[model samples]
Target: MNTTPVTSPVSNALAGWLATAETRANQKNEPAWALAKRSHAAAVASSLAFPTRDEELWRRTDFGGLPLDSLDPFAAVTPARNIDDLPVLLLTRLAGEGANTALVAQTDSEVVYEQTHPTLVKQGVIVCSMDRAIREHADKIQSLLGSLIATDYDRWTAVGEALRQGGAFVWVPKGVHAEIPVRLMQFLSGAGRLAAPRTVIAVGDGGSVTVVDELLSENAEGASMYLGGTELFIGQGAKLTFASLQDWSRNVYHYGNGRAQLAKDAELQWIQVMVGGRMSKTNIWFNLDGEGANAFVHGFMFGDSRQHFHLHTLQRHLKPNCTSDLLIKGCLKDKARSVYQGLIQVAEGAQKTNAYQANRNLLLSDQARADSIPGLEILANDVRCTHGATLGHVDSEHLFYLMARGLPRVEAERLVVEAFFEPVLERIPLESLREQLREEIERKIG
Candidate 1:
């Protein structure tokens, strides 16, 4: 019960919450070093200015409006659902295909499933719950988790670490290439409560794997909240394809973070399709660590009504001879607002790296708002980097021509959206998945 005094009640309460999480971490037998890392991050995050109406970055999104700290809907663990309809079957085929990859899955509350493909098992791949990874693979787990994107030691993130409940852990063996994608799904049920979905995947040198994370709701439009995070580490010469689909309940407030580290000659491809959260903020970071590394990021969002979706991307080039490219597009209507922020960075010694970033948006109505801010930071003299952002409305001429051809406004817009999204969705490697994803985005637009 060691609590220090703070200036604001909100800050004080936040401190108390962190203390509680630390106590739980100790109770769970987390090593002193792990707890120390959490404590240090908490301090730094707490000191940062809280977004208010005054801050330009958050003004458009309006965090001061939500009662984020008072939302006490979080639970420790959730039980598995016995269901008839399985999620995207073929995605599961990767796991059933024989373990060239290890898989770990935790629902809102508990570790519902885990598997190490038979092929991967024989290769010494270890995929299990993050808790187990922390406990058994203590040394490895300690080095990666929480070391990526610094979690803003807020009520939401503390709730994430304190009641983590369950999450996946993937470790690929050096030189092994997974033939399929490992799928992880989190479905919010009636026992519906706040869920923090966390996942960490590490690829050994020359190894490869694909991971799919799905977030959906049980009550078809139920109200829920999810604070989720993901991190990927690609060993030198490895490859990884990570897809994140945010389809939580329409009433859920979601904040998500995805990150990756690319070693020499490694490749990372990331895809994000945000369709169902009531309000969401997405932040993704890619760090290039070795020469000849590459990263590609693509994102699209369709939001309507009061939905507010924001995305921030950072492509950091830390080594020479790296290449990274990003393309993000969003469409909004019915008073919804969307935003995109992209920044590309080249370190002092990151010479010979080529980087590019671009963001585009389509506004279908006067009330719908879209923001695009693309920036670049170059520290190396010989590196090449560029960024671009565009925000515009559907061309009236295009709309008129479509309508003249007997297409309805909705259908016409659908066509335009499809065209705009194709550049991003086409990059999805799996055909079946690509089709289903296009269908989902179409439905959301409708």
Candidate 2:
């Protein structure tokens, strides 16, 4: 293990936790390289300060009182004995998805179950726990672990790097196509706990795959925090479809960061749904690094009570002939509040680049509020870029039209909210999953 410098900041919350980095790695039976990585990240994290409201991205959300020093970073859970032993919230969300090509489940910070189809295994497809991948596929993990998102990006990422545990990893060989989706489920419980999970996915040239990531939590008395990160790498001519849904309990604070890099002729479809948690902040980014690369993003959220949700997105064009589009819609009621910021940036030499961004919000209560900010930065003269945003209350004409019929006021409002998100929901490829999302959105409306 590397020696910790005496001059590093000792007042940071993660400084004390860094002292046990090596011991925790050894207890988990991790390899020497893994321990070395953890030690290096811990040393860096100890010097970094937690985020504050001064930063532009952090201005809308504040996590200063999250009780990081009191939470147990390495709280553990026993492995499940069978599928029936998994968290009920996770099982219920997966009820109508039918059969998946592969499935991985995590409870608290432990990976309890992993199942992959035999055919996918024969085709050189790999889907398993990140811990198993670190031991079995050390070479690959070593090369791509921090390739897309750096370990020292920010306070949350730095701490997550040093303390992340029990995640999922998926790899698809060249020229193969997985018709069904690969499912990843996570559930967090207990108070005064911190759950940090990282997922890495790579698709070889000419390969294709779909992934569904879900997060849930059981009710608890005290507050808990969830920090998650995801990285996706698409090779030349490859395709990837990703869907993420988060529904943590009211006592949980959620933070997520997701990014992807696309090669020449690559394609990506991204979908996001956020409906739960007392306060949440999320960042989604896509880099079009290769010519002819294309991407489309769709996202929606529903908030009620005193929930606060902040979302940010970036569409970066680094090569010529690249195209991207993004749309995010949200609804808020009661004392709920939301903030959305989106940017489309095009590099100097990236000509013929086409990009678009739009954010729309609906206020369902007098006290509800929302803010939408959309911008563009195009250095290329021949590129086409545009953006638009709208924030308004529910259309009274539409509500009155439905109410004049036989529907009640509450039911009319529900229908209007559902219709507002219909465009985004229609993009989902799976019918069963679409219906499931609809049901969940309707539940949130109430």
Candidate 3:
């Protein structure tokens, strides 16, 4: 690891925060192993320099305008007293009526609430805060944490891994199948505060589970920042469905890294939704490391005002007879901008691999901008790979036709926008989640 210290807004702030976190960890008698990981992560973070616009991954999204120095990494803020106090629509979408699911809610830096169904516990499923898991389930935690997306993957990842105060850990034992989803919500509150959350999920052989993770804010205040990471491990013949929704305040800057590893005959369905934030960048990666493994990755986003969103995805096939499909869609209005980059890679000896990727963007305003880039890397001869991207404005004829049907111009345009996303939305498995997303998209378009 690089040992030379760097001087920058992000690095300096993180260094100061690391010291405070270490002291707190010691005072709280946290696990030594967890603390050691944080210490190592801090060193890695200190040695690296902040990302700049020159980097290919960050070339289109500039973070220079962000007021990073003003944010407080260890700020103390109160979380919502109860789930009832949260946005009704959001809670409804997550917990549905009479749903028997495990739920976790966090604010700022700690998990304020957690609950798991009795049957799930009886079946040996574990769902709780990462802190608790680290202490009580050290064996399981130690085996997977930092195994996929290492703590030192990047500067922000290091910051999150070292300083994250709250998150969730979910595990489904062998042959156990969870009928309902596991839900986690992380809400940011107070101005100038920084929120870091980490999530780890593991599904045992022949087990199945679904997860819904959300990032939201209490209210729009001064500028804030959120750094988060998620890792998913699917065992042989296991199935996992994961969905993540990000809806931070317009004054917040958000960065996230999500990754998944699939074993032989395993299946994974992943969905990502981005709708809020002043500037946001997220990377999603999937590795098919076992033969007969399959995955489907989907993403949706709507940006208005001056918000900016950058989303990148990678699908890697490292074993023969594996397949992966990916689709990302976005709509931008006003002066909003979006950037999407996707890659599909078939490693050597990974024959009979099938991979597909596509990205589509719709610009609602002349001032709106969208950049889409799709790439492929194939080292195997008997592999099938295809990628494509499209950037276009809303169809004027479609809008005019709707308007002529006695609907107002705004309503007509809204309908057109909804129709454009119908294909992607229909792909979602959960009916409640699909409807909730549709409602949110409609609300945003209006």
Candidate 4:
């Protein structure tokens, strides 16, 4: 137990780290407002201290030996001149054939490759890196970049904004339908590097779009970290489906936060999938702010070896007649562990709000562990809110029955685990994504 005490953000160690990060921020040569935003974010981040084990939110996940201030802020990368120069690992991970309406590839802090379908271009869709968006579409992004997610909310978020490098920005014009998903592949190849990517997606009135964002890495010789953030805004009567998959190598520590807001009669489908990382913590929130708005949240995690996963979710209803539903399932093998916490809150005057949440975990080995906490707070009189959590191992009888049918023990267990996650998989609208998730799970189980 190395309880030397967590260092404060204002400590000399962090001040040095901030200076390193600021130097990287200045290298971007962005506009004046963008530079000012980064400086302001740095100040805000400095005011918040790092989370200690004493904090309720971080009590379960151990943070020992994690490098918070000693990391190389941003390792330099040779920018890819074109798509052909992109890494093969990244190119192979693209969605199934013809499944992507646009593709964006990133290596470290550079956007290496970007392409959008001609149809999408004609429909007034904007898909490009954050740098280009700030230069070309500042009017649209100025008000919404950090609006939904406040910089000072937490340690991860505050520092994420200050140090975030390259990110993808997406916009769907009113009434346009980007039916095919857009894929964003971000890969960190630098050892001991700290990578932070911020993404924002906005859909105009009556529009719809689907985006698949993948945060991944190749096998690294040394440990690294990823601080990521995402913000989504769904306009009136619009629809947006956002799927984020975290598959960093086991040598990475991952911290991610995302917030989404829905307008009147809007629909949002939020999906989170976790499979890699030595340790990971993710926070997600969905705000139903207009009457008739609805949101569906889905998440799944598979951990093996000594991996640790912590997932937190919030479904908030701020207007009458708004509805939200959430379900998250996870499976662990070896000495893996997971912690899940979820909350459903209905604010005052949010009458007729309907909300539901559930977290289910399955342990494959006796050494595996899972902790689930579900809660609800309702200030409205006419709201229906419910939450549930379940933790269990594979049913012996079910495995025996499968084995009796001439199946091997390992095969039987795989069958049971696959069936456990089938419900959530069936809800995914993209076949390619569902297949990719299954493939990743199979790799983990084996």
What clash pairs does model 2 have?
Answer: none
Give the poorly placed runs of model 1, Cα more than 4 Å off: 1-16, 41-49, 53-56, 73-78, 81-103, 151-165, 190-192, 219-223, 396-409, 429-432
lDDT, residue 292, candidate 1:
96
Per-candidate TM vs. native?
0.85, 0.94, 0.93, 0.94
Best by lDDT: 3
Error of 4 at 369 (Å): 1.0
Give lDDT tens digits, candidate 2, residues 124-222: 889999899899988777777756766677778777778778788999989889765788888886777777778888899999999989888887888
TM accuracy, model 1: 0.85
> How well is each residue in 74-105 modelled by candidate 4, as lDDT tens digits?
66777777666777767666533433458777
Clashes of 1: 6
With a 3 Å backbone cut-off (N, CA, C), the pairs that clash in candidate 4 are none
Q: What is the lDDT of candidate 3?
A: 0.85
lDDT assessment of candidate 4: 0.84
21: Cα error in model 4, Å = 3.8
User: What lDDT score belongs to each candidate, Candidate 1 first?
Assistant: 0.74, 0.84, 0.85, 0.84
Clashing residue pairs, backbone N/CA/C < 3 A, model 3: none
